[model samples]
Target: MSNFSSDGFDLDAISTQDNSDVIYEVGGGATVIQNEEPAMKEVEPSFNTSEHDQCEEFKKQGNEQFKIGNYLEAFDLYTEAIEACPSKFTGEEILRLKDEFDEKQRSEALQRSRLSEERRRKKEDEKKNGVSSSQPPESSKPQPFKTFELSQEDKNDKLAVYYCNRAATLQHMEKYNDALKDCDVSALLNPKYTKAFVRRSAAHERLEDTEAALKDAKAALELDPRNATIRKTVARLEKIEAERLEKLKEETMGKLKDLGNSLLGNFGLSLDNFQAVQDPKTGSYNIAFNQNK
Candidate 1:
């Protein structure tokens, strides 16, 4: 009724006056107050965006996208983020995104890998398993263990297999000494390897020697653990300790036999005990060869 619209009271002026009399008008008249600070948030940090920070940004963008419910895009973004983070950042906070993303990725990757591996393995396994196709055979995969018999090639192959398999088993058994020997033999047979080293590392773990174990593990991991046999070996070692002391002893004995054979071969397989008898005329001992046949 006081013509409120006509005056349109000076709100700004009122606010200014209120500001001045804030303390006075209240019980603490004319008192000074500390300034109110702005609330901090999970905002992007101000540090220079290095490759690591850039990766963080990618992860952040992914998270932001996820919040907006763009799941696919978020996933892709996170993938890029992880890839961008670089190997150096793997064990770092920068790589720290939602564990769900990683777990999802790991599950997906493992699933896909398993699927593909299964298919390929089946195809290969079918050859051995006799799960022939409906049609006649197009070709055949060479057997993994086509080794010869009682020959150098055979020994080499058997030794390799023995070492590789035994190394795997021993790793599970936590038999470091024996497992390491098998690994050494595996490598000797075929230097290009990851399985043996990886298994050997597991054996080292059983012995509670992390340093050497880590070294071997890293080396083996650096190689291919995707192999079915290698993966199986790893999996076996994961839950149990598999040792082959008997296998090792057999291998050692075989090697010793081979060594002895080689040495005897060099000497024409003869161990003749001979003493030099003096030749009276020349005052020199004649070489007497006592060949005990």
Candidate 2:
């Protein structure tokens, strides 16, 4: 401190000139920061809980409109709900979260496995000791395994419901293709959602794609086996698919016969000269060439 000059210690002696840099001391060293531009701030992604509440309100309004047969109004409300839903994480943050989630899942699985093994060993020991237990005690009973999920998955599930409801409205308006597109998004968002497949089946049926409709109906039935409506739909689709295939078979056979007759006419023969007999057991056709005819 004694070696320091008074001019160096004087605050007024420092130049507050017209330069674009500010000099500051850190660890007895001077550092210059440019004053021409402000430092950029780092922005963090945040979920707005209020927006999720707003989305739920919009969905309820849409349901009200749907029940009253106002399909267009319902579609608008559902679309608004979909738009109000918060965006999910993406990029590196999502990747990091996914890794953490996977690790947790693996740990839970290992824990469950060890617990199951321990229970089995305990039961075996009790049996050897002549324990008179007809069934596992309440505490030993297998508890339900809860499915874990990420926050984004929860938002996506809500968004899926909105898309599915909108798709139903589109179906009511006879916009089958548009409904199909919406159902596609709904199913992609939540594969376990059965209604999306049901709505898609209806749309495909309206578009006269019996095969596709049957497939989706069957899928819906599998997802909700106890649903009477889904079961009925699957049955109806199966019958329609069978009839369609039969009609297609007849048309194909007719076309083949015509082609055969056209080619055989060059030799003064016809398809009538070649009789097709079907084997009742095997459902195979035999073509016998009758030259005498």
Candidate 3:
């Protein structure tokens, strides 16, 4: 009675089909999803707490080795610990300790790198100049010069190396003042640093301070009497000094000659035959020459 099919209702007729897409109606309209979406696979995160424990365990082992004076063994263990957990073991307290470890490691690395670099540079320099760059004057800037903050623990040996090498760099720079300071440090850090003293001597020589250079060279010779290089340096410096003295004498004599000629008309004398005599005993000069004033 409510507007239904007045005569009859054809339910079978409304059961027709169309080849269009399937859409659902919700709030009076429908939207369609065309492509078939792929399904997602599940993945579990990798977090093995046991590995962290192992890392700690290895670090503890390294500490034990360090306590027992087994530095080499301690080094290996510490390396393993770092490899295991670089992130887990990061913190303020651990950072301080890690810095110590890092310093030690850096010290070792620097020694190796410096020596290898020196060899390479030396070979190249020798090839180019046909002489050993090592024989350069004390102020010669060192090849493979690099710097790093070093550990404070008995790092004298390590610092000695850097200071000595850097002194060479300073020498090459002609920064004699700074180079001498570095040499002092190197020598003080390691009294057995004979080369340091020898190098210091060379820098002094370059600065024309022969007295200090001779003293340093002597000290170096005392430490390592057999070093041919140091011996040669001493010989070269001695020769230089001798030549300097001789040249100085010649210069003084030339000045005296000029002075003697300049006295030609200074004193009015009847004849040009006047003579000046220097007494060998008194080092006093008695002059008799034509004077103008």
Candidate 4:
């Protein structure tokens, strides 16, 4: 005899309830939540870390690498620092500031126009009434214009330093043109930066632009007279320039001589047939025909 109790207990009903409960739990449970997917936790977006702080950190790393003569690494770090820099305000903020500036400028312009009109009217009235005086009318004290100072978003000093350092790295890598561009940017940012000028001079020297090199070296020397390197650089560039000019002069004279010889050959009278003799008194060369070749 099987031990089975009828007792109105349906096993099928219990199995069905079990399956339904499992499905409901997996499906997020409860009749109100039926057919609904599991709720996902709302995640708030994280704000970016301070750009100035990041830039400073990268700059520090770059300087360390530069000191170790790891130029490529230093350049990369410097680039990252530059990219991380928040040099300008957001577009919306800039627009708002510009609007305010424009409004203020418009108000000032209107005021100036009204004042000019009033002055013109007074002048005309005086002229009509024959109120001319020998002495010039008392000049009104000039009003002090309002000075508005806008806050800069980036650290200009740091940026200039980065550019100057990067230029140095590029120069060491023999990338003269790239180095020169960086040096230019550095100098524009900080006009008093002597190192930028010095680096720029080096770049020009490598590019064989002796004149530009000398100019920058002189500027650098003026800024830092005690710098022996700049003095030596200036001397070297001047010598190079002199030598280059002499070489160019020789080349030009050689070309002219070649042309003359070619033309003389066409006439069946080569340059060898002519002898130039310097007149002792006049210091001028006189051409003498040579009968014997």
All candidates' lDDT scores? Answer: 0.45, 0.67, 0.53, 0.62
Per-residue error (Å), model 3, residue 235: 1.3
| 3 versus 4: better lDDT goes to | 4
Q: Once superposed on the true structure, which residue ranges of model 3 sit more than 4 Å away at CA?
A: 1-158, 172-174, 190-192, 208-214, 260-265, 268-293
Kindly list the per-residue Cα lDDT of model 4 for residues 75-173, writing each as its tens digit: 899888766755453323433564677679778867877886787688888899998745466445554455333343222445566676677667667
Q: Count the backbone clashes (under 3 Å) in each candidate.
A: 11, 0, 15, 0
Clashing pairs in 2: none
The TM-score between candidate 2 and the true structure equals: 0.59
Rate residue 292 of model 3 by lDDT.
Answer: 44
Candidate 2 Cα misplacement greater than 4 A, ranges: 1-48, 88-155, 276-287
Structural similarity to truth (TM-score) of each candidate: 0.24, 0.59, 0.36, 0.54
Q: Against the correct fold, how does model 3 do in TM-score?
A: 0.36
lDDT of 2 at 140: 49
lDDT of 3 at 78: 47
Query: What is the C-alpha lDDT profile of model 2 across 186-289, one tens digit per residue?
Result: 76566666767876877787799989988888887787777676677778778989999999999999999899989999999997888988999999999998
Against the true structure, whose lDDT is highest? Answer: 2
Candidate 3: count of backbone clashes, pairs at least 3 residues apart or interchain = 15
| TM-score: model 1 vs. ground truth | 0.24
Can you list the residue pairs that collide in candidate 4? none
Superposing every Cα of model 2 onto the true structure, what RMSD results? 27.0
Q: How well is each residue in 1-293 modelled by candidate 3, as lDDT tens digits?
A: 11111011010111114322212111112212132332863232233788657755665575455444454565466456545642322223333554566687778777877877787777787889887565533433434433333233322433343455445445544677777876765665556666577667867876888878877887887886776656666676677777888999999988876676577437533333556789999999887664542
